[model samples]
Target: MSTPEVSGALAPGTHSTGAHSTVTAPPEASTFRRWTSRCGWALAVAVPLWLAVGRLLTDSAGSLTPVYAATLAPTLLVLSLVALAVPARRPSGYPSSRACGILLISWGCGIVLGFTLPDVGEGASSVLGSWAGPGFEGAAAALSNPLGIIMLFMAVLGCVVSVRHSAHGDGSGRPRDTEEDEAQGTGYFPVLDV
Candidate 1:
């Protein structure tokens, strides 16, 4: 009897009952990749533009310069996203939940790093409020934007979300990395039945 086309893998010694075999269906891909790609592209463009704006505005002393840390923070996230492009260069081929997870964490780290850097004059530390304090904005005053604020929120949220999500996950709401059984021979992509 001809075997059935299975979408999920059949148990060992379990044969399809005449064209009724269960084919193991590969797990669904993640949507996080979508957000990752979007965020990366956005930061890549926005960060540079903002940096330029910061330089232009801060041409003179006490002219409202952007926080150095802010520029540095988004740059790290942009680079990470550029490399991963929503988990992997090709989203459909492989779901790099772990890579994506790491990138998310990196994004959060970048945010913290940005804040840690000096927020005063060129190479000045803001920990002591180099300029004056809240009363003294300093030459390199912090710049704010709707996009930037959103990005910051996203960074924190990404970190929180990644606690459960992982690269090996099927994104089908199943336990993460349990799809080792889903992996086939060869590279990162799961082997599809031809």
Candidate 2:
């Protein structure tokens, strides 16, 4: 007695031996995921160095205050860690939930920082006076100040990039993958079937 042929359903290198067929497991991680993880690590290392350089340039003595390091370093570290933790691929959808959450959090932080932290430059201090208070005026001042303005611009840019990233599954910022491409090529595995 003969069994039914499964047609073109077998994997690229899978060989059918009688009735018991061996199937190959998919890859542990996609190329995109691996790259994203690597990038996260790179960013984790680079951000502190970049911030330190900026601080040195800004200060005449090139000395870092303990308070400045304590506050800013941890905030940046957490943000970078969050970037590392976010998955490379997400379902195709408009205005990704994760992206929106991050944007909101950034906006809140920017506003709070504007209200609390003193302006750095003499020009900024002269223009935007002290706004530390629990009032609507403080919020308005936060939106108008230089730091707040830069933060708003950055948050918007992040939103646009995140939306684009969410639209593509592979996180390549490209169109969807096709089935024909998958079927035609031999993936990472070497073909064992003749």
TM-score of each: 0.38, 0.34
lDDT of 1 at 34: 56
Candidate-wise lDDT, in order: 0.43, 0.44
Query: What lDDT score is found at residue 118 in candidate 2?
Result: 37
Per-candidate clash tally: 13, 0
| Highest lDDT model number | 2
Instruction: Give the least accurate 10-residue stretch of model 2, judged by summed lDDT.
Output: 123-132
What RMSD value applies to candidate 1?
10.1
On the 0 to 100 scale, the lDDT of residue 43 in model 1 is 53
* Positional deviation of residue 113's Cα in model 2 after best superposition, in angstroms: 11
